[model samples]
Target: MITVVTNVDLFSTFQHVLQPLTLKPLQVVLAYSGGLDSHVLLHLLARYQHLYPQHAYLAVHVHHGLSDNADAWLGHCQQTAAALGINFIAEKVVLNVGRRESLEAQARTARYQAIAKHLNNGSLLLLGQHLDDQLETFLLQLKRGAGVKGLSAMAAQMPFSLQENCLIVRPLLTHPQQMLVDYASQAQLSWVEDESNNDQSYDRNFLRHQIIPSLKLRWPGIAHAVHRSAELCAEQQALADEIAEIDVVTCAHSFSGLNIAGLAKLSKIRRNNVMRFWLAAQYLPMPSRHHLDKVWLEVVNAADDANPQLRWQAGEFRRYQGVLYNQQQYAALKDVVITLEHTLSQRITLPDNIGTLHLQDLIQDTIHNKSGVDSSNAIGDNDSGCCVKAPLAHDKVTIRFRGEGTCHPVGRSGSRSIKKLYQEYQVAPWLRDRIPLIYYGEALVCAVGLWVCKGYEAQAGLYWHVTRER
Candidate 1:
């Protein structure tokens, strides 16, 4: 079995798995740790690259700085990759652990982000997680009473980003830890053994050192059986996703919201499934069973006139006026005011990475001619809010949030207070305070992106049009 774990089996596996990749162009990056598993991965990939020279093979090592010998491990990875003629890069990231976050999880999150920086639109990130690692994750999820998604464990292939363009492929997921050790031995390859792995205080380390060995002693094929069970869970998850896809199309009308009525029609199990897909689509954290139950009963089944909400560790969901809105409450956006420079077109980065504010000045006649024919070549939202006459040569323009009083909005009947208008428009409460109010001195000009005050409507000359993009 040790001899069978040679480079021959490794290369054969790579060839069989990557045959589809030759159809399109994409960079393959190995997540090298200079550990036994990853070292074997890099060694095999370096040899296989000789045959498939058409593909780019690179290795990335993230120096988490969690271990005392992290610097030494990074150096070894660089030297080994250089000797194999493989392009190597190293990134150092600090784990920002808040009061609620654990160091282990934070380090993993930071490490993945650091590595993802090097990947491009169609990159393939190869992870070195193997069968033994999968078993540890399975047991951990089981102990926590995780749902189907968690029980599925690590996938052989998965989208690494929300855009689904980049992929994370675990090529060694089927191979056992001992096979990697033997393969490294067969090629006389050397690697690091992290001291932290021996620390049983960590959940995975405890499972690896304390529980799994004893289980394997009783059932020799325990690892393989657990992996097979994980595969079955993944299949069930896929089927559930298919059901969610159909239901999501019915309830999911927009990117940021779902239709309340459509969701109410789904069965409890189906509703939870759709909710999971909806949250996952937006890259929000998945809530647990208890929180999800509260969301279904309170949020999904609330009265049409009632505003019901639920907050979990990841985010919050609210239902209002027959619509459901998903809010990432934990990701606090800066509540600061940004000035609008009227002198030129500019893009301003919003606080808390909300998105960018796009400001461009436009001319009224340039947008549409007096005869209803296209006239001036200026851009406009065809509304008074976006069609303000350009600022006077001496006017100092600015943008801010929160204001009071009444004004007739563009394309509305009668003047109304901003507060009443907010209720009339059925705007989400969270957004009412965050909307940017544009001002030209004492008089209100426009509610950026929402409405333009009546008196400030553009007539003929150039005006400012502001938009926000996420």
Candidate 2:
């Protein structure tokens, strides 16, 4: 039975839902879209704010620019918020329609990313997702053959972003959409109707308009039942996550890398669970079952000496030295040579998002009196503290990603090829070309953070440092 809600009952329910959250007087931001659901929520929040004036209220509208009336909708939201005496902020986002994902998915992602900017560490973001929305989401995930985590649907309350410490709360999640309509009608509220909502081309609209209405006619309590099932799935997912957490600790290596040996000890199902959890921790997109199987059969199970890699749209998985590493696909740097003049202190920005290079004059007091020491016989220091002799006025100094010939680094005996030096220093094969190499004309002088050339070592002169962007 769908019971009509009075204005007083709606406000009271809103207050009851948010009572626990008001203890700290946190900023409450409503994702206001000037639609029926959000307008009702904003009206209720305005009434609640009158009683609990300690908590700050803000209405944020994300302009996706997808609809023709997007600007008009923004104006309506601004006017409504001003009348309600709540702070208002509007953000415009550009959607990448060319991506492989659906337009609906792109819009939702852009909306949240735009809204996430205004949220502080402890801010509360209120969404207007009601029971009907939850039902549609549940059915959509079910149609996709989702697992427990996906079938759980939208959470009523969850951390928006762990790094931001922001909480997203849906106060109206338990309430029916009809109840919101009733409250809005009784309150004499005016809200905009999005034409896109009636477009049956979208999956959610098809479910909402054609499929769900019949389902409700057959089973009036279908929303409640679906909500209950989603809640059960959420509970089961929480338990699975707890198990994954324990397994991840045992399998993880160096921060982002996973030890293949430790992973091989687990069963196939448990191993996949750990992989999903590990990828989530790295903020990488979850791979499909086919892709995940490829990761296991092709990458992790590859021969110890074979270099295997798997690339996806968001990120890639690479196996090196018996460890699986999830890494972003960085574009290959071009052979762009950058000239560095003799300056006391200078910072050079590398292309292709490589990072900045800092060059500063070494203090004279830090230099050891090596006049008695033979310069050619001195070994070069491979540590970051290593400094190079300042280039002469006629010296053509440059920075390059490609280097050749032999380099005798400090603290190392004799000279070795650049490739040999890379292997000896344990530099990853993928990162060897990315390391900035300092050159005096054609001769390699310093490998930035790796080592300074033996004869070019300065007792007190310019020091080179490279800071990676990623």
Candidate 1 off by > 4 Å: 1-8, 96-98, 162-164, 253-255, 298-309, 330-411, 414-421, 433-470
What TM-scores do the predictions have? Answer: 0.77, 0.74
In terms of lDDT, the best-performing candidate is 2
lDDT per residue as tens, model 1, 377-455: 3334443225565666566666666667888887788989988877776667676665556666656777665667776
Off by over 4 Å in 2: 1-8, 331-427, 431-470
Measured on C-alpha atoms, candidate 2 has an lDDT of 0.81
Q: Give the range where candidate 2 is weakest over 10 consecutive residues by summed lDDT.
A: 370-379
Q: Candidate 2, clashing residue pairs?
A: 379-410, 380-410, 380-411, 381-410
Give the Cα lDDT of each candidate: 0.75, 0.81
Top of the candidates by TM-score: 1
What lDDT does candidate 2 reach at residue 382?
Answer: 40
User: Which lDDT tens digits does candidate 2 get at residues 308-405?
Assistant: 88888767788876778866655666477888665556778887666677776655323543232223333243444347888877789888887677
